[model samples]
Target: MRRLFTGLAAGFLLLGTAACGSSDGSGASDAGAASGGTTTLKVGVIPILDVAPVYLGQKQGFYAKRGLKLQLIPAQGGAAIVPGVVSGQFQFGFSNTTSLLVAQSKKLPVKAVANGVASTAEDGADFAGITVKKGSPLTSPKQLAGKKVAVNTLNNICDTSIRESVRKDGGDASKVEFVEMPFDQMPAALAGGQVDAACTPEPALATVKAAGGKSIASNFFDVSPDLTVAMYFTSQQYAQKNPELVKRFQEATIESLKYADSHPDEVREILTTYTKIPDTLLGRLTLPRWPAEPDRASIERLARLAQQDGLFKQSPDLDKLLP
Candidate 1:
């Protein structure tokens, strides 16, 4: 479950000025010299397992070695972070592909910079699942019709996947009511009879199961197979103005992703430093597939799915959206 931060206006204002001042009018770089001549880049991210590589990069000095100082700012969801990136408050942001595509369709000047997370088919490694209370009468996605389902955000990955899952199961996807709730609060909400089911992502999925929630369906199984679930993005201006900085950021991120892929224990240990998830539960949390580079095909597949789900008026211009 993700914890959302409250105040960002003040931070946005302060950072926006800094970011604009750093640009030299040539679209050559987003990094600017601070007190010690180090370039500081503020990044907006949700505090989840998907962002583990970002934390790992910081902890291991992968970005610092490239003369980039990363300011990892946490937000509740993409709704908050996308605006920060668009307004120059954050030089870059991490969000799901669905949110970014929606933003791009609406003409938000953002381009994906790096891969964030992906899904896998390995047993016990389902990163997201639709869960119901233990021994609930709802045994399958079909039963979810006319029932209230909780998701971290509306019209994003969780909601879209669950809707598709229901449709694939011969359920009336349109009848399934989707309620917006934070992943962290979903378990309690489910247990309290507030929501019939929850489309939850790990480690919230793990936490909910520990609290007696049972999985009805794996969200990724039907809607998105080996999907590129999330990605790191920056404004179009930032990418064009600072290609070198973006390249360096991508390099550091890929290195961290590879490191995290090979070292699960270390990744979990680093995750504790950013997320409030307890150390004991970290071992049980399902980890996402951390790709070394963003896959255009997977992203295009997601865009098509989002379009088919009515999330967009028209297909997003992948040529311009992908970086």
Candidate 2:
């Protein structure tokens, strides 16, 4: 996968701090004292449309103005970043709500610091879907029974939602097979008939559709209306020990989200710098709903789904999991 660290590195330097830490034992907090005692935060992120706000916030100096320096480390998926956040290798991280809930169920010390991406209201843009190649016999979710489906990660949002969608459409979700594959690769996978269908989010959704793949279902809405797809989080110890830092980070993130919400063109432009999605495809991508604050109801719903899906032995304590 192509990484987009160049622009992020320059953004950190412009904020008067090195993107990565120096050798003086000042790792995440390596900001110079002259920069108003700035704290450098190593953030774990996936290079997808959902994380555009973080990049936009950096480009607009939102975090820097709040005495924070963000170094974005790209991971293949949310599950891969959980260990880093727990180990303090990443001071902050982004992951889907289901992944965090599962981690919290196992008593991981992670707590959400801010909201990331969400689903739109009914009939709004489809940010996530199950795509099948055009002219395929499958036209509805019910037809997916006994068929193979592709998801970025197993036992995460994609897996959970796809099953829920198929079941809701009267299909035997248990009979369906799920294959793990990266979102960016789903388009090719679908075209090559590697999987019967691909569960993907934008711009992969757009990419698959552009390549003659038709969406059989909107996974986000099918799972729940106005679903909170992902969130930003930190270890519970880190948030409690540095409450001020957490507050500043949240404020900066919210500001950036608002900017991305209001300026789609600019957000897409910024995404082009960090993601491998081509400039022409940027205009065709469906942007996820980047809400400024985490929604309690949405999160609670996810926990309930996790319990139903048997991902958690019991529903996680939403009060402790959320910020």
Please state the error at residue 187 of candidate 1 in Å. Answer: 1.3
Q: What is the C-alpha lDDT of each candidate?
A: 0.77, 0.79
TM-score of every model versus the real structure: 0.88, 0.88
Q: Among these predicted structures, which one has the highest lDDT?
A: 2
> Which residues of candidate 2, in runs, are more than 4 Å off?
1-35
lDDT of candidate 2 at residue 122, scale 0 to 100: 59
> How would you encode candidate 2's per-residue C-alpha lDDT over 171-259 as one tens digit per residue?
88878898887788888888999999988888888888787778888887876787889999987866766677778888999999899
lDDT of 1: 0.77
As for model 1, its CA RMSD to the true structure in angstroms is 4.6
Error of 2 at 77 (Å): 1.4
The clash count of every prediction, one per candidate, is 3, 0
Question: Which residue pairs in candidate 1 have backbone atoms (N, alpha carbon, C) closer than 3 angstroms, thus clashing?
Answer: 27-241, 28-241, 29-241
Which residue pairs show backbone clashes in model 2? none
Query: Can you write out model 1's per-residue Cα lDDT over 268-306, one digit (the tens) per residue?
Result: 898778777877788788887898776777677778777
